[model samples]
Each structure stands twice: as structure tokens, then as C-alpha cells.
Target: MQSAQQASVPQSDADRLRARAVWLYYAEGCTQSEIAGQLGINRVMVVRLLADARRRNEVRITIAAPLGDLAGMERALETRYGIGRVILAPFADPAGDPTKVIAAAAGNFISSGMKSGMTVGVGWGRTLYNALPFITGATLQDFRVVSLLGGIAAARRFNPAEFAWQFAELFQGEGFLIPAPAVVDSPETKHALLERCGLAAIFEMAGQLDMALVSCGGISQITTSYRTGHITESDRRSLVETGAVGDVLYNFIDAQGRPVEHEVNARAISVQLDQLRRTPERVLISGGREKHVALRAAILTLSPTVLISDEQSAKALLAEG
Candidate 1:
């Protein structure tokens, strides 16, 4: 319910009546017939008022089911991470990989949560790529999608540009991408690409995104980051030795969520940490027992307002905390 104090001026009698009817119907569990009588309005008007409230995002309805069977853990993680919302997908095994389930959950959330006329930044991985089938595309207006990272060259499975382009296609929005390699030979080349070329402008656009969708990668296994051969096993070992837990947007970070000193981080072409944080609404998506530590670090580093994972991963996160 919106408080009268929240408004700059007093609400008109009609507006107040609408609020009262909404309160009676949704919050008070009153039937539309009952609400109509109390508000001295017809049942049809009450229905319209309730519809208006929901359309404005003022009244959200979430079934206490879904990953919600573990609602206690979801709430706890939200408090522990200072996150606004936590979403988890059910997994039969705590030790099993929860990528597909989590991806499906993330897909459902993205399909609904993303509204028209918003600029969104996207990060790519197997999880996000897998979410494609589950995601229901929509025709939207004034929507823009920005690829937060560079593309992997000759990558058969997942590439940043491919994901960004497909995601934009899903919403029929304009897509902005960094037309460069994900990792370069040297920091000097990275500087030249950002300054000399036009990629810096893309990063600048990303810095002020309305929302950012990202996921983390654990170092326990040679995942996509290593499988691509851009990040070698030796480099992974070196990163873990430097107290790195995992990477977000290829910015390898430690347990404290601080980027560790590494040549890989320096030469990687992607959105900067400062730019990522500048985005108000950030969503971090990843899950699995192996990623618990990395997920913890990602929560600290990204400070995402929303987190999506699996119940087992959620439990592991709470236990670790």
C-alpha cells in the first residue's frame, strides 16, 4: 500500500477510493463483491482498479511455491547478502550441477521482469545461453540491449556478441556490442582498442545501464573460461593461488570480491567494475555446490539487487556465510 505521506499532495477522493478497493481486494482478502459494497462501487470498477494497481507494478503477486519451498533460505540469503530479492530453482541433489534448472528459472524471471523502454546490459555464458529456449520473446518499444563484454573468437558454444544479438532479437530491441576480442595480447592493445577505437563509447553506454544481467564462473573446474583456451589451466591455477574465487565478466576476484592482481584481468576487454556498480538494478545468475564460494564473492563484488540460483546452491551459500 502506498502511504499518503509518500505523495507530495493529498490524493483525490476517487484515488483514495481506488487504493481502498485495492487494499480490500488484494491485501485484506475481500471478494470483489464485498469490496464493491464497502467502497460503494460496482464490482467491475473494483476489478479495473485492481488491474490498474498490478499494471503499475504497485501490486506484485508471487506464488509461495516454485523455489519458494526453500523460502526461509531465500529470505536469509537476502538479509545476509543485502540483496533485494533471491530466486532459487529446486534441485534433487545438492551436489549436482543446477545450471539447467537455474537457467530456466532465470529465463522465466527475465521474460517478465524486463519491461519495455529500458536499457539492459547482458553477460554471456552457458547458463544464459541455455536460458534462451525457456525465454519467451516479446515485441517491445524503446528497449536497448548492450553486451557488457567482448566476444570469444572461434567459440563454438557461447560468444558474448551472439548472446547479446539473440537477446536483443528476442525483445526486438537495438543491440550494442564491443566489436573486439574478449582477451587481447597485452594491456597496451586493450588501451588502444578502448581509446583509439570506438569500444570505449560502448563501455560508456554500459556504465549507465538501467539493468545488468550477469553470472559468475567458479575456478574449481576448467569451465567455459578455460575451455575456450583464452584462460589456460595454468592461468586458472595462478588465479586461485592469488586468492581468486572466480570471475564475473572475466574480472577474476578473490573471496572478498576484490579483483586479484593478474595479467588476465588487465588485458581482458569488458565493462569495468565501477561501470557495473553504477547500474542500479543488477541480476547475478549462477548455481552449483562448486560455485558456492565464488557466488559468495560475486554477491560481495557485484552487490546485485537480485540473485537467482538453485536450492542446493542457496543452502550452500547460507552455510558458507
Candidate 2:
């Protein structure tokens, strides 16, 4: 009886250690080393205690903002578009940079949603690139990131491959990048590469993604797609002629959220819009007066689970008929 009582004492102490570790790490937001110092234990022991706490389901984190601030707009957007969650970021200057504000909010949303094992698909644009700096670093096991589009030949800050790689590094996860150019010479070439050049593996992975982070681009001279020379003047003219308002992943869409019929649609090398819609958690992060039509089209097309946008864009989206 004495031996059994002594053994139970260690187990009881372990429970206390795990509880303290969880409180410090999750509730107090302390780093592992800080927790170790506070508890008079080694960092490795602190790490184990936290892991054990997680295994015992002693830690659950939730992110809740005061909805009263943006509740009106959020409710309007949610009611109109059937969006699952709408996070409207406030800006001191309504005319200020929408990308910066939205990106910051998106970074928080993504960080909170992520878990130990998740396969995330990322799209590229200036707005998406802005989110990179704001993502918090973490070490997640079995985490993976896949670039949903092919790379742009020209070196640019917001390249698809670069964004995907950086996002993966933020979580210390594996990254799978599409090796082909953003646009191939022809539809046949796109099909050939996807069928024979091992690029199909990336697409297959995209199909099984747990979450997708994507942004839209308005078809304007200032838009990243046009400014980067990915879409030429003639391409723009032809796309407009076909009723394209904006593009998601280089796939042009009209006001009605249907893909515009154009040759560029066939030559584009990216995940299909329909597949994006099927992702378990689709997050659309984009805003700006220029993107009003484009953003509206995306909401109708993707039915994003979460939308991170500015107040102005939210009003503009609601104003649209």
C-alpha cells in the first residue's frame, strides 16, 4: 500500500504540472522558455508538460473580438451572402490602405484557425502578400502548404510560389509549389504538364486541402496582375469584352460570379474556382473601392467561410444590388 501511494503521488504532481503549463502557455501567452523559468523547470520539461496537457484535452484557445463594433456590417454581409463568418476591420482613415488593414486582420484569423496538422492552400496577390509579415510563427507537426497557382516568371514580391513558401515557413511546415508558369502557351500545353509533368500531384493535394487562403484582383492598371505584366493590354481588353470584372487566381469572372468565356481561361495554370469553393474552410481576404465588383463576384462564387475586409468595402458590397 505504501508503494502504490508513492506512485500515485508522482501522477498527481504531473497533473498539477500540466495544468500549470497550460495556464502559462495558453492563458498567459508565455513562451515555453518563459514558462520553464516561471515554474523552475527545464524548457524541455515545459514542452512535454504542454504537450501532455494538449493530449489530455486541457487546453482550448478561442479568439473573440468585440463584435459590437462591427456587428452591424458583419450581420448585413452575413445575411446577404450567407457567409459563415465576417470580420470587418476598422480603419482610422476610411480611405486608407484597405489591403494593409484587411491583411492584418486576416493574419490573426489564419493564425488562430490553424492547428497542429493542416494542409493549407494559398493564392497570391498584394493583399495576400501583406499578410505574411503579420502571421505569428509556430511549429506545427504534419502541417503542409500548397501553392494553388503556378509561378510567375518575373521575380516579384507577391509571387505565388514565394507567398506559399513563406507561409509554410511561418508554421515550419512542408511546402508544395507548382513549377509551371502562371500561364502556358496553350490549353493543350497546360493539360500536358498537369497530366505528365508531376504537377498533378500538387493539384491532387490542393483538392484535399483543409483550408484555402485566397484573394481577388480587380482588372485595373494598378492591380497586381496587370502591373506585374501577367495580364497584357490586349488580354485586359479581351477579358473586358467578355464581361470579366476581376480575377481570382487568374481565372476571370463576371458580375454574376460565373467564369468569363475567354481564351485566357483555358491557358491559365491554377486551381479551378469550383475546387476552391469545395475547400473545407475558404477564406477570402481582399478589399478596396477598385475591388468592389471583383469582391462581390468572389463572394457569390466562393461563398467564403470567412471574409476579412474593410468597412468601406463591406458597405460597397452591401450597396450592390
Candidate 3:
């Protein structure tokens, strides 16, 4: 009689059974009818409950699918991140040369979007610098290209101006140069440089960019452009201490999407983060597991509309998250 009173209180036997059924089906590989029979329930009820398990979001299916199928992963990532577009380069060997693929993909992306009457902002980095040569001659009538960050004068690779010129030539538009070094000797120098007429004009142009092209750099002191003399050691240490993960256009941001504090950043000759955010379409092109942590940090900070990267980096990033 006491047991009968206890049993009178309703319990979700159906939900409990459904969860068990899913475990059996997925983990134990038991057939639906087998589970139903074992649980003393109707086969149809078992099927309904199994589906209900998914419908009510009780079970989350995780498929570690390869990024070789560009269409599905691209869509998944775009929807998940609320990004406008996602481009994945060819993964020839499933583990091929990342650098070459990044350059090729960037080249293809630039070729497709390099049109007339558009103001394109570009940031300096090796990958983006490499892609410059791949951009063949095209007539960019009335288009413009602006440097998103200041030019690299101290530790030269390829000139940011040259990269800007390539895009300008492709679109037959004007090339606006941000003539200040990416990092200055001091914050005072940065302020002075920003007030200069020629550089200020270019920075203004960058603020009005329609689209931007940039690459994410690594956090490693040894790997960073700053450590390589592209930017000073003091600047690198300061940025790191301020929680900067990596940079796109010399605008550093922390893990929680907060901009790092730096006196030089305010009066710097480079295009500002707020300016980049205001730009209608900021596109970032980058890849690598080494940069995965920094990439996520950048995404949180900038919220770029589109990203062009290879499979390895994408997988690494997704895994990281």
C-alpha cells in the first residue's frame, strides 16, 4: 500500500527511456526494435522518443567531418559564427603546405573582389605580402587602395605601398599610402606622424574603406613581426602584457575582445580599430594551428564578415573553441 502511494507520483519514464534508447542506438548499436522490446515499449514509441531526444535538443550530434567538403563546413562555420562568408582552400594531401595554399586562396579571393570604385584597405604581413605578386594586372577604374596600418620602414619585407599599388593597378584606382612606420620609436613620434598631411590623408581614406584584407599574426615573441624588428621589442612586450593575442592592422585586442591599452595606439598613424569596425566589410585571410588561439581572439575583437583560410587552421580553430 505504501509502495502504491509512492508510484502514484508521475515520473518521466518516457524521457528516461528515450535517453537510454539513444545511448543503445549510438553507443551500443542496438536496433530500434531491439531496444523497444527490451524496454517493453512499442516500436513506434521507441522511434518517436529517439527522434524526440534530438528534437528537444537532448542529444547533440558531433561529427568530426573533414573540411575537404568545402560546401558543408563552410556553411556550418558561417552559420555558427554569424559570418557573411567562409572560404576554404584546397587540402591536397589533407596536410599540405599551409603557406602556399593561403597565398593561392588569397590570390583567388583578391582576383574575384578587386573591382572598380571600391576603397580597399590592406594590412601588412608576410602571407598578404606574398599574395601581392599573385594579383595579376587588371584595370581598376576609379578604385582606391589604402594602407590599414602604417608602412613597414624599419624592418622591410615587401613594401605595403607596393601591395597597395598592385590593387590600385588592378582596379585602375589611386593608391593611398600610410607613410608612417608600423611601430614608432615613441608615442610622441606616433602623434607627430599622425598630424602629417600626407599620412593623415591616407589614414582618413582607410577609415572609409569598403573592404579590408589582412592576415592574423602569431603570439610567439620569436614569430611575431614585432620581435623580428618589424616592430620594436618594447612594443611587443607592452602589447603582450596588455593581453594582446595577435594583431591584424597593428590594432591589438585581448582574449575577451577588449582593445589593449597603449598610449601610442591613440595617436598612431595607423587606421584605428573603431575605424576598421565601422568599415562595411572587413575581410581577414589567415591560417595555422600556431595562430589558432590568436585567430579566435581576433574574431572576438574585430568580428570580420568574411574569413579565407585552409582546412588545418579551420579545424584547429574549431577544436580550440
Candidate 4:
């Protein structure tokens, strides 16, 4: 009995170590090198332990491959649309859900790219705002966050100025605001605002962004900014009649993702899509199943280099094509 007990001690210790290793590896996303250094074991040993844990069912890593389980949806859509990257947020009821997956991915991308002296232009939307929490505590260099579009419109609640300030504060960088209406009553007013010395300076800063972030407005006029009083209700009807699906940076795009021939959109004091594309990297985050069609329109029309969205949006996009 004593000899048998003695033999079981080493196995028991190994089992416990393996269990710990599995949790740290899969749950924590620790790299193999990190695991080895932390455990004071060879990297190869760490891999072996993880493999053993999996084999024994001590570590059950049930990767919920929804896009795949949903019928290879993500892969098909990525290929069809030529999207550089596509992420599907995990959620049971995606239509009624907030896009946590896209937000996390966008935050990860931003956090990884943050360094000193970089300028990042931000757009206003629920998705872009959601990404802010994930970007916290990153040691980025003295960067500046500028709003690509003016947030100070009729709605005082979802003010883009405050949003930009919060993001700049979070990143420990300077926040630059355009300090004008997102859309004016007329194109002449927009042009005049653009030529203003005060606004010109901000536009110059916005034009020179190293990186940019934006979101897509959905096709539904009901939930559109125009309908929500961000733009006049007349503007909303005009945009729909003009074939506009939604707007990006308040610039209306038609069903084919082409910019509509609207004077207001043409003169809007916001970063142009072409200018945004010229930036080294442009990240576009959009969410909601209701907005999936709009997201697809933006992807096809704007040609952003990167996209972040929830799984339902991703799956919906695949369905669109």
C-alpha cells in the first residue's frame, strides 16, 4: 500500500500541473513561450502537457465556430467580398445584441498599433464607442485622436465631441474637435464653414490622420441619423429618394455604395472617404443585424482595409451576397 501510494504522487502532481497549464494556455491566450517562461519548463514540454490535457478531456476547448457551424459563412463572405479581415462576434441573439466581438477585435487592433506620435481619426457610432473600453490602459505614444465627423448636431445625447474627448483621454492624447454641426442646412453653409480659418485648422488635422476609424449607418431611414434628428427629416426623405442606403461620416451612399449627388453630402465638413483610404490604415466598425446591409454597402463602396462586426452581421453579410 505504501509503495502504490508513493507511485501515485508523481502522477497526481503532473496531472495538476497539466490542468493548470491548460487553463492558462486556452483561457488566457498565453503564447507558448510565455507559458514555458512562467512554468519554468521547456516550451515543447508545455505543448505536450496541453496536448495531453486535451487527450484526457481534462481541458475541453470547445471553440464555438459559429460562422463555420452556420455553414462556412465567414469564409465564404471573406472570399466573396475581398475583405481583408472579418470577425464574427459570438452571441445567441445577434439581432438584439450589442457587438462585443467586433468591439474587442477593433480594440485589439488599435491597442496593438498604438505608439507615440500617431494620429488616429475616429467616427461616431455605437460600435466605435464600444471599442473604447477595450482600448484602455494601452501604452501608446503621444498620439492624438480627432473626430472624422462633427458630433455636435441637434441630438445633445450622443455628442461626437464628448465621444472624441473621452477617447483622447483614454488614449492619453490630444483631442481635436471640429466644433460645427455634422450637417448644415445647405451646401453653401458647409462650404463656408470649411473655408473658415478656425474650422480649416481642424480639417487640416483631420485630413492628415495616420489612421482612421469609422462606422456604417444602416439603410433604414427610421433609425438613420437624419430620422433621429441628427439631420433634418427632409434630408432623410431626400437621401432615400436619392437612393441612399446610409451615410458614413455623414456622407450619404446609395444602394450600390456610390456617393449620391447630394449638395449637403458634398459639402459636409467631414473627412472624405478618399482621404480616409489614403491613411496608412482605416478601421471600420459597424454592428446590428438591421445595419448589415448598410455594412455591406460600406465595405463594397468605401473599400476600408479592415472591418470589425458582430457574428450576426458577418453572417448577414454572407447572406446578402
Instruction: For each candidate, give its TM-score against the true structure.
Output: 0.78, 0.78, 0.71, 0.72
Cα-based lDDT for every prediction: 0.81, 0.82, 0.68, 0.69
Which is better, 2 or 4, measured by TM-score? 2
Clash pairs, candidate 4, are 89-311, 115-141, 116-141
Runs in model 1 deviating more than 4 A are: 1-68, 225-227
**Between prediction 1 and prediction 4, which has the larger TM-score?**
1
Candidate 1 C-alpha lDDT tens digits along 1-321: 333332433558657776787688667879768898887766656655654454445554443444447788889999988999998888878667788888888988997877788999999888888676456566678999999988877855478887787787767688999998888989999999999999989988897799999998888878564247588888889988999989898899999899999999999998877779879999999988778899899999989999999988887787873
RMSD of each: 14.0, 9.8, 24.2, 14.1
Candidate 4 contains a number of clashing pairs equal to 3
- Ten contiguous residues with the weakest lDDT in model 3: 1-10
Q: For candidate 4, what's the RMSD?
A: 14.1
Separate clash counts for every candidate = 0, 0, 3, 3
What is the model-wide C-alpha lDDT for candidate 2? 0.82
